[model samples]
Target: INSSIRSTYFVSKLRRISQIFYIELTPNKNLIMSVNGIYAEDSEGKFIPATQRPDGTWRKPRRVKDGYVPQEEVPLYESKGKQFAARKPQLPVGMSPEVALASRSKKSGPNVHCPIPGLVVLEDKTKKKKKKKDATVEKLANDLTQTKLDNTPPDPAKRLKNLKKKIREIESIEARLLSGELKCPEKDQLDKVARKIEILCEIKEIEKQIYWPIDTKYDFCRRL
Candidate 1:
């Protein structure tokens, strides 16, 4: 009998606790419903109805439906053609479009002119300076050529020394070639041989000139 009474007491306590929990939760549920039904202010400062999304998040509403426009409504975007038309220059009264355009182009600048449509002709301002610079360079080049011609005949002693140095080099190269110490392509070897022959001929000419002094009066005759 005592166990049955204890069980009844526990069951009554559980019912009382459940009733208190329901009373406490009822006001919160009502508050959530009220908040969901509330209106929100959009960017335009206009109050619109707030909506609850399927994910339980609230979506702020706009006065107009999102991304929805009536077919009869004016488009929000301005086309390139309409923009070009709006930006086109207004012609003066009694003036042809071509005449007005030409007048405007003339007023723009003297340096910029167009003889043909779509082709701009620019005057080169540096042409005179470039011509002057070129003339000075040509004059300098001519002076250099004249100096080279005046110094064409080298001193005999210096010329002999140079020839002797070249002959020594050629002899060394020949020795290397014979001993197989220096390797060269067939074409290079042939060219070196030809050069050695020319140097020998030049040395002979120089020695002849040094041994026998040619009279300047007979020099012209020898040329003939």
Candidate 2:
């Protein structure tokens, strides 16, 4: 019985040693090679050590006859995206571009912290900022319209004459900005003034038409 036990122990020891030797002799599993004559470029910009991954992890492959080895080619950034029009790459054809982009661009990693609902207040404020800018522009346009139509000192001829006069004023403002005769807009007060002037100038001609009554043109000529 003791002899049988000793023999079994010897067999187990021999098996463990043989397994370790086999492991040491085995080729690395990570090295990629072509079954057919095709091989992928190493992408590492150097002969990838015949036995290593791009990340510098070691692997094993047959060395070429010439000591020089080819590296993997790097991909071009292709400022133009996915040019082949191959259904945006993610979806088959006939899908909407929007759906294709969304699907193809889907993130494929670990779970992330979005804080989306938490950003509600921040996004709301940002939206409000844009709205405020629009409202301010609207207000500025209104003010310009008011200025042009105001013949004040409330004089009829002066009010009637504002369009040409206003054009000159707008031009003067632009000249000042261009010539540096007007201090740079980086100055706060100047920026406000510049913003007001820009909106007024942009819609000046359009705004003028709104002020003039098309139907009343006959009446005005009659008055004249």
Candidate 3:
């Protein structure tokens, strides 16, 4: 009686626990800004702006210096005969091909490596030669496929065919019905043997056409 009462109490506790097993958890979606601030690396330097709360999201960029105007408006602002260009002479290649009509094939930057002093040379030809050598090495690689074929045993097609043929012959022999003179035990043995042989043949045939196109299965059975 005591054991039964104890089990009942435990089961009741389990049921209560299960009732509230999954307490719905809500994610706190209201975002608070990170304390460290976001940092982005650039060519100039690592950019980390001060967390200016007063000028936060509503801030606009300060206006450019007096001479500067929008690139399109600058042309109109200048006099017709004299176009204004930056005093700074650009790198020899100038700006992009589409913008300034500079030659697209013009070299971009100087080579860093200086094997021989005083000559700022590009190791371009040496790189090409190395690539050619790599190609030639790949081409001369021995075809190791023949070695693989030699190591592997011959195909099992002939063995499989023989086994199937033997199974068919055995099935034929077992199918002969026993006379009344033969006991029930003998007749049962013959039936068992015939069934086993049939199964073997079926397995072999299935193996042969395992990759066949389709089966003539009933649509109702297939759907279920």
Candidate 4:
């Protein structure tokens, strides 16, 4: 009987604690009413300034000055003190800086052995003479070609045949152009064809007339 009474008492206490917790968790109506009344008190909304800043506008943006070192100043180097000095090139013994520079300027030939003092370099004149003789022979051969051309007579029959062939080819080209076989005809080619046609006509006239025609001879015409 005592255990049953104790259990009932514990359950009743838990119920009372739960009731108090529910009341505390529930929102207060009075606080919500006060907040709504504060908002409605003023008809117009709270005025916001045109700009957030007190100066009315922001100051000019700062200019970038990073990596803008002066030209007079030397840039930072990885090496420091003695290590940096050691990195510089050192000249050999008995060699002055000016002498070293002069030696570098003078390029040694492929045939040169040692650049020691008092080195005798004898030039082979026999090879130079042979080369000069060969060049003279070549020049003589070129001169002989002009003489041969002047002495040689051109074959009239071969020239006439070539001229006739050119005339035929020009005619065929014109025919192809008229038939629309050639899309873009060259002006230079057309002019050449016209010139050849004129030449051919003159040659034909020369062949037809054996002798020059004589006009009436007068004393005044002979003086002019």
**Best model number under TM-score:** 1
lDDT of 1: 0.62
On TM-score, the stronger of 2 and 3 is 3
Give the winner by lDDT: 2 or 3.
Answer: 2
State the displacement of the C-alpha of residue 149, model 3, in Å, after optimal TM-score superposition.
4.2
Q: After TM-score superposition, what is the CA distance of residue 175 in candidate 2 from its true location, in Å? A: 1.2
Off by over 4 Å in 1: 1-104, 107-166, 180-185, 206-212, 216-224
RMSD of each: 21.5, 24.8, 34.9, 30.1
My TM-score estimates for the predictions, one after another, are: 0.30, 0.17, 0.19, 0.28
Q: What TM-score does candidate 3 reach?
A: 0.19
- Pairwise TM-score winner, candidates 1 and 4: 1
Q: What's the residue-level lDDT of 202 in candidate 2?
A: 38
- Lowest summed-lDDT stretch of 10 residues in model 3? 22-31
- Number of the predicted model whose lDDT against the real structure is largest: 1
lDDT of each: 0.62, 0.50, 0.46, 0.53
Q: Which stretches of candidate 4 lie over 4 Å from their true place?
A: 1-127, 150-154, 173-193, 202-224
lDDT per residue for candidate 1 within 1-224, as digits (tens), equals 99998997786666557644543454322211222343333344323444445553555544645443445454578899989988875764455777656657776565555575444456676975787799999999999999999989988778887988888877887888889887763776657666876776676667667865665233322332
Of the candidates numbered 1 and 2, which has the greater TM-score value?
Answer: 1
